[model samples]
Target chain A: MIGFETLLRWLDLAGIAVFAASGALVASRKQLDLVGFMLIAAVTGFGGGTVRDLLMGRTPVFWLRDPALLAVASAVGVLVFFTAHRIENRFRALLWADAVGLALYAVLGAEIALVGGVAPWAAVLLGVATATFGGVLRDVVCNEIPLLLRKEVYALAALAGAAAFVLLRMHGIWRDTALLAGMALCLAIRAAAIARGWSLPAYAARRD
Target chain B: MIGFETLLRWLDLAGIAVFAASGALVASRKQLDLVGFMLIAAVTGFGGGTVRDLLMGRTPVFWLRDPALLAVASAVGVLVFFTAHRIENRFRALLWADAVGLALYAVLGAEIALVGGVAPWAAVLLGVATATFGGVLRDVVCNEIPLLLRKEVYALAALAGAAAFVLLRMHGIWRDTALLAGMALCLAIRAAAIARGWSLPAYAARRD
Candidate 1:
């Protein structure tokens, strides 16, 4: 049987790999060079966790502890850089890949905070941050309007997952069970949102 | 003798306040709500330090322990929200205010890293990150091109200051003297860059 720690680490790695690929895909579309691909992929892979770690006071950062995470990201960046032209529907592929990362990261981020002794509310916020902030960084670097600034179900989906984690833990559910449930809930919502073109209300300011 | 720690704290606070104001001004330009103003200001005020501390392994985050930083940012947000229209030459004022924050934060961030046992080279990078990242965050949230991403000498100025800090410290220069010199170097460089319209070359990618 795989230890829970090993399982979690694998889950985290998978999330990072997918997110890095998504970021690199965006970089490819922008005609960024290898440096841009590498940088964007690393940032998109680690951005959310970096913000969460900073806020949660987890120092030296997760990526710093594990060099392999960055290696995976760079490898993914290289792969995408060479193969992007062969891939059709890059936009749809990016969305689906991002959704996978979003779901996993939302749950993993909250677990990190809870393990670090943060309060439940703060944990939930960290989770949402972890799931969303990376994409925010990617979009900003690519000069795209950030997803957070748009009226989207993106952040809300992460929030729902985070809240579910907290609620489940409060109800004395097993952490493993709670984790999977949270991930599933987020994934389902996000998948549905994509399938249905769901969105939150956009804020329209008065010209005057 | 005046303690270096106390002086740096005050310098950091001054930088935070100014950066917060700059961020709020952007929010006002966008006609954001109070919440938007507060968030942007706070992010601008503390974003650099937060990143620095996380990298340096300083936990609990500085502003979390001391509420004054957030309070200062929020106050600045309110002030800007009401007075933005009254201010003449906001674009010019923003450039100057940002210059002040950049100089102070450059030195302060380097100092934090040095005190936290960071290597000098890494400390210099941290310093540049600390000085420039708040503005980067502010621009991203404001939907503008980040100054760092542009062909500007902004980050170069911070890099100069951080290098000065490390050099001075290495030479056994008095902490206060070193700090002042570093800030001066950064400010002068940035001021000259602005006045002369000096810029770095933008990267052009090859399609092949």
Candidate 2:
């Protein structure tokens, strides 16, 4: 059986790859230059975790300390840049990849915060940070409103997952089992919401 | 004599105003809607410190618990949107306002980090966060390379100011004197850099 730390590391890697692919696809859609594409990929892959770590006062952010993540992201960026045209449906790919990244990050972030001794509420906030900040940075660079704030279930799903993890822990559940369960729950909810166009009600009055 | 806490409060307020103005100007240039403009202003004014506080394990980020800062930033956004044309030469105004904001934030961030029991090096990093993250976010939203990563001595100036404060404290300087000196130094260096077009060496090299 894989150690919990190793599993978390793998999930982080997968999250990075998924985010890089999504960002590179967006850059390709915009016909951005190679440098721009690389920048977007880097930001999308590492921005959220970096922000969370910085907030948590974790020194030497993961990517800065580990060159492997950057190498992998760069390689993925190059591959995506060249093969972007082969993808038949960019929007669908982006949405699916982004959802995967969001779920993975949400779990990783909450787990880290729990280990770091943060309160359950703060851990949930960190989970949201991990899931949403990268996409926020990507949208900012793409010059658009962050999709996280667009009446979507993106951040809300992450928060729910984090809450589930916290509740399971409080109930003395096994750590690894709780994490996996919470992550699976978040991914299923997010995917279903996206497929059905489910969203929370906006604060404004609804005409219908 | 003004109390130390009172001085810090005033500097924090000034930093918010300057940061909001810079963000509002950028939003105006980008032709963002009122919500977009307010969002930019709020992020620019509080994003860095919020990140810093979260990292330091401080609960309830400064602006989140205090609505006044958000209100002020929104007001500034509205004012800038209406007066954008009148404030024609935005470049000059942005430079000066950004410099003031950077200096004030550097001092405030360092002070907050110290109060939170962070190390000197970490305090300096917080200072840079307070001074530079807003501009970085603004540039990202404007779809440009971050000014800190491009032309300008922005982040470097913040670092220098932070180091000065740390050194003064090490040498037993009064806290107020150290803060004022550091802030003044940052303001002078940043303002002069902008006025004279001084910049750090670009990463590119001359092709032989």
Candidate 3:
């Protein structure tokens, strides 16, 4: 049987690939050059984890320490650049892949923060940030309004997953079980929101 | 005689206040709420430094270490919120203030990286990133294209400043002399750009 660390590592790479692919698809839609595709892909893949590590005071960041992650993200970007046009429903495909990546990153982020011995609330916040911030960077760079700042359930889903993981860890649940469960909860909420057009109430600005 | 560190600290606070005021003015233009003003102001004030420290492996970040920074930024945001509409040319005011902040931050950022023993080339890049990234964050959050990515000489000015500072230091110039010279160079370039509409050559997308 594979150890928990091995499983988590594999999932982390998978998450990075999916996120990178999403970024490349955006670049394709924008008609950016190859360099733009690769840069956006790499940044979207590792941006969240980089932000998380920085906030937690982790040195050198994850990508700087492991070149493999950059290689994987860049390769995925290239592949997506060629194939994105072939897909008829590129936006839908990107959304589903993004949801999967979101769930994976959210849980993994929480676990990393917890292991770092940060406070539970801060860990949960960091996890949500890690899962969602990469996409924010992607959209911002592409000159689009980030989905997170919209009324969408994107950040809410990540928050739920990270919060669930934190609560489970506090109750002494098995680590692997909690991880899987958190991801499942996050994905389910995101999937439902995507399917049913769910969104939080729009902010009503009050003028004094 | 005033010490160098004290001078740097006062200038740093002034830069933060100016950046924060810029953000608050943007929030005013967008008609966002008071909370939005404060949040955007604080984020714009510290975002670049936060990014620089993260890249340099500086833990806990500067604003976290000194809550006074946050207080100053927030206070500037509040002040701007109440006074922005009275200004005849708010956008022009913001531009000039941002130019001053950009020069100050670029020189300080390069100095910080060099003092931290970062390689000179990387130090130059970080300084440019430090000076311009907060404005990028501010624009992106406001759903506008960042001025840094446009054809303007914004980043180029910071680059010139940072590179000049590094070169001066390498030539054994006094620290204070190098700092002032760098800022002067950056500000002169930026003012010329603003007055004469100077910009880099536009990218021509090649069809393969």
Candidate 4:
């Protein structure tokens, strides 16, 4: 049987692939050059975790330490560039992949922050950071408003998942179980919101 | 004589003004709406330190706790929008104002990190965070490559100043003297770099 550490590593790799694929998909839609595609992929794959780790004073960021992550992201970018037209229902695929990536990142972020000795509230914030920052960076690079800031349930879903994770952990749930439960909760919430076209009310006041 | 705490608060406020102005200038260049302008100004003014504090597990982000910072940044945005056409030699003015903001932020970041019991290297990293993140965020919002990533002496100048500040503090230098000396060094370096058109080498390979 594989060790828990090995399973976590695999999840990390899967998360990177999903994020890179989403970024490349976006870039392809924009008709960006190969360099631009790769740039977006890399940023979307690593930007959030990099920011979170830097803030936490973690050194030699994860991708820097594990060069394979870069190689995988780059390969995925290339693949997407050539196969862009082959993917059916691009929007649906992108949304699903993004949801998976968000869930993985949120759980990983919460775990890392908890191990880093951060307070529970801070851990939740870090989880949101992991789930949302990659998309924010991708949107910024593509010159659009971040999806998180839109009248959507994106970040709110992540926050709910994180809070659930913390509460479960407090009640003596096993770590892996808590993480999986949190990720599932986030994925479910995100999927439902997308399916129902659910959205939060815009913060701006309505004009007369 | 002004009290030390009062002086620090004033410096922080001044830094906010300069950073917000720079952000507003970028927004004007992009022809963004008033809401966009305010968003850029607020992010540029407080994004770096907010990330830093969040990572350090500090509560109630700086601007959240002190609403005046938001007021100052908003005022600067409005002022820039109204007077943008009348402003002359904008590039030069922006360069100088940016340098002042960078120096002030670097000093403040280093001080805050030191108080938080971080290592010197981490403190220096936070200094760079304070000085450069606003510009990075602004560029991202404006859909441009961040000035910091373009390999200017920008981050280098901040790092140098941070090192100087930490060194002086280690030798028991008075806080005021150390702060002044460090800020002066960063401002001078950034100004010189701009005047000389200095930049880091591009990532692209050179053709023979």
TM-score of each model, in listed order: 0.62, 0.59, 0.62, 0.61
The prediction achieving the highest lDDT against the true structure is 3
Where's the lowest-lDDT run of ten residues in candidate 3 chain B?
B81-90
**RMSD each, Å:** 7.1, 8.0, 7.0, 8.1
TM-score of chain B of each: 0.92, 0.91, 0.93, 0.93
What is the interface root-mean-square deviation of candidate 1?
4.7
State the DockQ of every prediction: 0.16, 0.10, 0.17, 0.10
Q: TM-scores for chain A, candidates in order? A: 0.93, 0.90, 0.93, 0.92
Better of 1 and 4 by DockQ: 1
Interface RMSD for all numbered candidates = 4.7, 9.3, 5.3, 8.6
In model 1, state the lDDT of residue A84: 83
Per-residue CA lDDT of candidate 1, range B1-208, in tens? Answer: 5577787778777788899988877776666655556668888888888878877778766765666776788798777766666643457877877898898888878988988898899999999989988878788777887757884689899999989988999999998889899989999999999889999777899797
What docking tier does model 4 reach? incorrect
**Candidate 3 structure, TM-score to reference:** 0.62
Error of 3 at B188 (Å): 22
lDDT of each: 0.82, 0.78, 0.84, 0.80
Instruction: Enumerate clash totals for all models, in the order shown.
Output: 0, 1, 0, 0
Displacement of residue B27 (Cα, Å) in model 4 is 11
